[model samples]
Target: MIGDIHGCAKALRSMIQELAPTKEDELIFLGDYVDRGPDSRDVVEQLIDLQSVCKVIPLRGNHEWMLQSVVSRGMDDSMWLRSGGRATVTSYGGSVRKIPEEHMAFFESLLACYQTESEIFVHAMYDPSCEVATQDDELTYWTHLPPSLPAPHHSGKRVFVGHTPQPDGEVLRQSHLVCMDTYCFGGGYLSAMDLETETVLQVDRHGHVRRVPVERFAMLLKGCVHWFRSRDS
Candidate 1:
């Protein structure tokens, strides 16, 4: 499972190759596939293509909610204002007003509230008792979070989530729940989790690779854009 891709396909593609998923293995995405990164468009295209080749599971993040708001409510909602939404609009050449309503609808359809099968997964939900089970229940998924995480997560089926970016890529916060956003779109590392073993793997925009122990990623991995600038200077 992976979290909050946020359009970092360069890092994502590298991480996926390293995992070397097999036909039987699944590649589930925790959502937030767009916004705050240069490759939001590319990420959507990749997900579309992956539908044929892999078990690509997508959950809706707040970013996806923003796109929905743009479609259903006309970008008047704050979902598209905060949470790095402006950067995303600017990345699309700063004329968000001109972007077609139909295109926004396409983005909304790709997001989900939760996808579960023995393990509960979402973009940023952890309330074991949450009634937010469907796409319409999406508001709760983003607004509410449990103060305490349930233990022996297999009992809760190991809640995998993203949206909270820790200093590092993955935080083994309570053994069962893993926060894997890793802020890849912010030039942080992209993270992946091996569900069966509960182990983590990661790869950044640079040529670095790591297996779990993702605490140092934010400090160690600078933005690739920064790397490009340094080379030019």
Candidate 2:
């Protein structure tokens, strides 16, 4: 699974090359493919092209929701424009109208969440009280993970999400949830994780690559638990 791209095409390109995934690999992107960086246009184009190389599942982020509201529903774009939409417009040659038909279709087709037997993927937080299928848009695409860990989802499947940027370039890992947004557009890394092996690969816009070892569960949980207890006290 991959974290939010946020228009950092350079980092995205670098990470793809580093992964060197084949047709046998399935890539899940936790969206925000546009806005706030140098090349939202190229980022979307690359994602579309990736379909030919692997099975790509893209989720809708709040940024995508905002863009869709403007381009598809013909709503006021002023809010989106102020919130990094201008960068997206500039990436598309200074107008949203220049965004291609195929790209529009891609945006329209993005999923709110995807689930497998043991894992659930969404762009943002999920309601632990509800099933993944029943999650509302606010929970699926807008809400950030709280400072303290949330209750585990009722399904017993691990939940993976992006949207809450980790400025320190670390994956926010807990027993039940993992947040991969490393804030690439803001000079952090673009992060990807291998679920089976628990390996994390991070790439920067300058094409630097790094591998982060997954922390031992006991140690990770111990520290987090301590923090939570202290916060409550």
Candidate 3:
């Protein structure tokens, strides 16, 4: 599974080359494919191309919701543009109105959530009090799960989420819940994880690939904590 791309198309392409999954291998993108970077158009275009070769499930993120609001509800562009929407607009040749019909459809057709017996793939959060079928799109696309929510959630499925960017810039796993959004647009790496093997590969904006082991992740976390503490001191 891949984390929130946030418009780093080059990094996404480089990671895809590294993984080199065959036609039988399924790729699940956690969404937020656009915004905050320069290549939102390229990002979506590459994803569209990938669908012809492999199974790709793209879930909707809060940014996509914002885009939907602007495109469908006639919501003011300012709301979306203020939150990295401008970059998307620029990617489309400096006009949101000029965004292609196909790209708009791509955003509109994003799934709210995807589930297998072992894991639930979602862009943001899920309601622990209700079944997925009973949950609303609002919760699926917008809700950021709080720290108090138990892992495995209410469905007893390991949940993989991507809306929350980790401060340590590493994949955050708490019990069965995993968050892979590593703040790629904010001077961090774009991450991917092999769900079956628990292996993680990350590529930065500069195309530097780093394989993260459990111990490496622990050290990254410790460094982030110490950096914060030193700043506070």
User: By TM-score, who's the top model here?
Assistant: 2
lDDT of 1 by residue, 149-216 (tens): 44443245666678777655555456466677786766567878787776677777552676445555
For model 2, residues 94-192, the per-residue Cα lDDT tens digits are 988999999999999999899999999999898888987777888888899888878899889999999998979898988899999998888888999
Give the clashing pairs for model 3: none
Looking at candidate 1, the ten consecutive residues that score lowest on lDDT are 131-140
Clashes of each: 1, 0, 0
Q: For residues 64-154, what per-residue lDDT tens digits would candidate 3 score against the true structure? A: 9898899888988887989999999899998878888988889888888889998888888777667765588777777776867654677
* Candidate with more favorable, higher TM-score: 1 or 2: 2
Runs with alpha carbons beyond 4 Å of true place in candidate 3? 149-151, 212-233
Candidate 2 regions with alpha-carbon error over 4 angstroms: 211-233
**Backbone clash tally (model 2):** 0
Q: By summed lDDT, which 10 consecutive residues of candidate 3 come out lowest?
A: 147-156
Report residue 139 deviation for candidate 1 (angstroms). 6.1
- Model 1's lDDT to the true fold? 0.66
Ranking by lDDT: 2, 3, 1
